[model samples]
Target: MKILQRKRKRIAAVLFTLTLMLCSCGQHAKTEQKHDWKAEAETASVYCVGKDDCFLCGTDAGYFGQNNIGIVSLNSFAVMPVEINRYDHNGQLIEENTGAMQMENFQNGENGMTVSVMLEPDRGIAHISISPNGDATLDLASAASHLCCDCLAELVSQLYGSVNGIGVVNFSTRRLYVLQEGVTSFGAGDYYVHCDYEALGGEIKILVIYSSLRYENLK
Candidate 1:
């Protein structure tokens, strides 16, 4: 009877140890699952392809007045010449002032760099400023032609110029002001051009004046 009792006690001890080990393993698994859940929730759906592409992400990401500037896709990022002078001081051709867009690291989904472009018309000048916030603004020429009163006034109301309202101006006589808004997947700025021409009997003569500005932001 004494030997039997000893054997029973040993069996009980072994079973208890097995139970403890199983419980410990279960607890560890639960902890690991919790950690994985948190990681999945914080991960981003998209990623930058490279530094240059990253800079195109932040251009015109916000809503300004009536218009919203934003990147169409990650593929739009590319290196283009950066125009240093608003007016080609050396009488250089407009195409000669081109600059390249250099890509950099991603900054919280914002492009690490910024760019600016200016547009000047013969009768007036406009300033288009873009930032990483995707914010854009069009400061119109204070003394533009009265013919553009309604059109110009509407454009100033919003950062992204309204394509519909601008269509009212006679394209031939009315100088078309164009400002490229953003760069690549993340970049921001405005494209502005000033037209100094008049429509006479359906004929348009554009006066090539130094009234346009184009620039870039290296932030």
Candidate 2:
């Protein structure tokens, strides 16, 4: 009799497990992957890529503000150019410069970068600046002068730029928004088509890790 009762209990448990698994599917909630802010700031790499081809898990990244100063973790970051200036300087090395998003490969116009620590939570943390170059200046000549960031998921890999993908985590909103530039994808041949970020200062997107959209208020 006891053996029969045990068999019945096992079957009941299996049914419950199956039910839970079925219920868990089809949920589209954005969850933040917790990390130490200090650790991220300590080993951060600032970079950029043509916002054209870069995409998310199959979804077109869509265009962002002209100033795409986005961020992603080291492990998640894609390997792009090491630096911008080759002869006069060495790889975005402007003395105090920590690093850059060398977007020349993906940009169509005057490629420029602006640096900032405004994303920091408070004044106490603001002074702990990430880039040694004291918030690199924006490409004044370029058309775009703001910042946008993106991070990709398993849906589909970006056409170009950093493979890790860039995204943001908003604790207050309990939401995480991934950064993507446009709906279309750009290829090697396309690089020269719109190439003019240097002279025209068009849409420039940087991979950043900001906490809020307050950057929209940047002067």
Candidate 3:
């Protein structure tokens, strides 16, 4: 009985030590994950194109002419594309072009700028500002009489159709009234549609930015 009791106590001691070591390891890992890279990296002023040749000073990412800038979280790599064109200033065409380009070495909280492009012959123009937090507001407003709302709707619809389970796609051409609100409303320039899909496991909200854009599967 005495020998058995001693063995049980020894086993208990070993178990206690193992538990403490595991707890310490867990705490160390948590501390490591809390590290912030932005606080450590040096800040350098850089310029990005903002609104038709206008440039803003920010961090230099060593690449130029990129249309899209995304900030990625270190822990999850969750990417948030910074507001490239918030104002829809020259309408969505400029925003579309801006979104077409890819960014490199761009970091969060970096001051950025964008250049506006004159793709159309019309002199009438507008601009909108989307905040870093995704709040958008129009800075300038002008009627684009020649804006093709139907075409824009078709483009978005076509891109959405390519996705599996997206059905009965409907397009609407409406002039956007609220510059800050992201939703596409009735207008002659901006058009948007509500789409529903049967997703596996549950319903998912898929905001199809560009209809007819297909993603390639990278193995």
Candidate 4:
């Protein structure tokens, strides 16, 4: 009788676990089904083309005493192009693949800055500031824009080192706004608790600025 009872309890526990798994899967599927990925991709493509060009400033100089600038844009699939041209003072261009992690649906912020997004500049963009120096701020209000949280964190981690750089991430906490249609939103907090990826529907935005400390190398 004791053995039979133990077996029954084990079976019940397994059934409960299976039920939970099924329910979680069903919820995830429902969320994905409700989102319109095709529409989002189309809208993002149009916005990428129509939006003003943004710039990324690196810490070192590829020109004469000036930080190299990266022109940023989103492609049809919402991925940023890896090949960026660094233009010299005379307008001569040198192409280099920066090997920077690509982001999705990223756009220019105030003053056409690639990494910073100002939803309402006057009121100040809502953000969870991460770095103590106030260089890394995670935008908390952008709905349609998205990037990879891990990529943003990787950039942020680089900031604390000897490297001359800054980073930012933009994400939404709104329950309804899914960053990437079918992608899960809960794991975004692995980077920074305050800059919760779920806050941006599992999407992150980044802003990195490199100082011009290496300008002498170009000369």
Candidate 5:
């Protein structure tokens, strides 16, 4: 009877150890899922592809306030030149006059890097900023153009899943409430698009926030 009792106790101990191990693994997985997307972006190679015409100050393109700046991963290399000039002399540099995002600029918290991309000599826009925490901000130009939608889609494509399969949709005047003039937000699958009208400055800002576990299955 004593031998049988000892065997039962050993079996119970083994089961308890297995349960603890399983719980620990589950918790570790949950933690990884929470930050997987950020890890990918933090490690991936990013490039700032800006137009040559608009890169320098006082160009003809700058006079018209037309510039297309692409902040993307190496996978989405396009026609634009990767080399960029200093746009925001006032903002803190990750390195002196680097004019590009660096590894040190990538972080998971409030102190994420923000830089300005000049449209012209006199006017500059804080157009794009990104963090290691899988979050980014694109301050769209005040002009209510379809290009803003394209820019958002382009950025999203590089960060999360491919937007190629996703249907093309425009940010209509009705949706942005351009006439109404206030902050409004709407959902787009795993992302949130926010439209804000700065009454004081008379400027329209479109902020896109990525909100989903799109990288939970990243291998």
Candidate 6:
């Protein structure tokens, strides 16, 4: 009887986990269909185009010097050419592909400067703050629009695979944390968390900033 009880308990636990994943996925699907992705992408693009261009600042920027600008990366190496674009300082399209990345909102704040930008392929826009000391955090204004369902679930799993709503995830050794609140981190080895979690119509969206130049596989 004890063995039977143990098996039942295990089964129950599995069922519960499956239930949560199903619920989350269902809610996310509904959320995606409700939002206009193209509109979201355009809006994100327009906002950043008006701001300053600085790619070097987002990923773990403290190691950089005054003469050194920063680097940008994709979530994965499977970069398709059409996914990137180049813009002149005048905001003129130097060259563009189906997907484009634009950096903006490079300014000084009490903690650090707010880094705002957009990534194509996914076309999510994130507004994040970094301290002069290289600490990373995101605010309410930070958002990830135009995200896809698969990417959403994958990103969620990266944060310890918790289904209890999208929340803080720490890969401290990698010096990476994502989708959290009031962060005070020292460093990490990789870009683990790629988005800030924003709840919309029962679904979650992630807004992210890179603390290092490494392109994370948010998908």
Runs with alpha carbons beyond 4 Å of true place in candidate 1 = 36-219
Give per-residue lDDT, candidate 4, residue 110: 29
Writing each residue's lDDT as its tens digit, candidate 1 over 10-99 gives: 999999999999999999887744443223212321221232222322223112121112211112222222222223445333443234
lDDT by candidate, in order shown: 0.29, 0.27, 0.28, 0.30, 0.31, 0.33
Q: Highest lDDT, which number?
A: 6
Give the lDDT ranking, best first: 6, 5, 4, 1, 3, 2
Q: Clashing pairs in model 4?
A: 59-210, 59-211, 170-205, 171-200, 172-199, 172-200, 173-199
Error of 2 at 21 (Å): 3.5
Give the Cα-based TM-score of candidate 2 against the true structure: 0.21
TM-score of each: 0.21, 0.21, 0.25, 0.25, 0.26, 0.20
Per-model tally of clashing residue pairs: 41, 48, 32, 7, 0, 15
lDDT of residue 151 for candidate 5: 36
Candidate 6 wrong stretches, greater than 4 Å: 36-219
lDDT of 6 by residue, 1-219 (tens): 999999999999999999999999999988744644344344444323111222221333232221111211112101011112234455454433545455444433343322333454233223332221122322111222212333332333333212221123222221112333333232323232333234333222334433456466886
Q: Could you give candidate 3's per-residue lDDT for residues 1-219 as a string of tens digits?
A: 999999999999999999999999999888765543233211111211222332112223221223323222211222343333333434243433332343323222342222122211121222212122211111111111111333222222322111211111111211112211123322222212222223343332222222222576789
lDDT winner between 1 and 2, please give it.
1
Error of model 5, residue 200, in angstroms: 50
For residue 109, model 2's alpha carbon misses the true position, in angstroms, by 23
**Model 5 bad stretches (over 4 Å):** 51-219
Query: lDDT of candidate 3?
Result: 0.28
Leading candidate by TM-score: 5
- In candidate 2 the C-alpha lDDT for residue 185 amounts to 24
Off by over 4 Å in 4: 2-10, 26-35, 41-88, 93-219
| Candidate 5 residue-wise lDDT, 1-219, digit = tens | 999999999999999999999999999877744544333333331322233322222133221221222222222111121112233335322224434342212222343222222222122222222221211232222111222333333433333321111111221111111112222555533334454444233333444443546467657
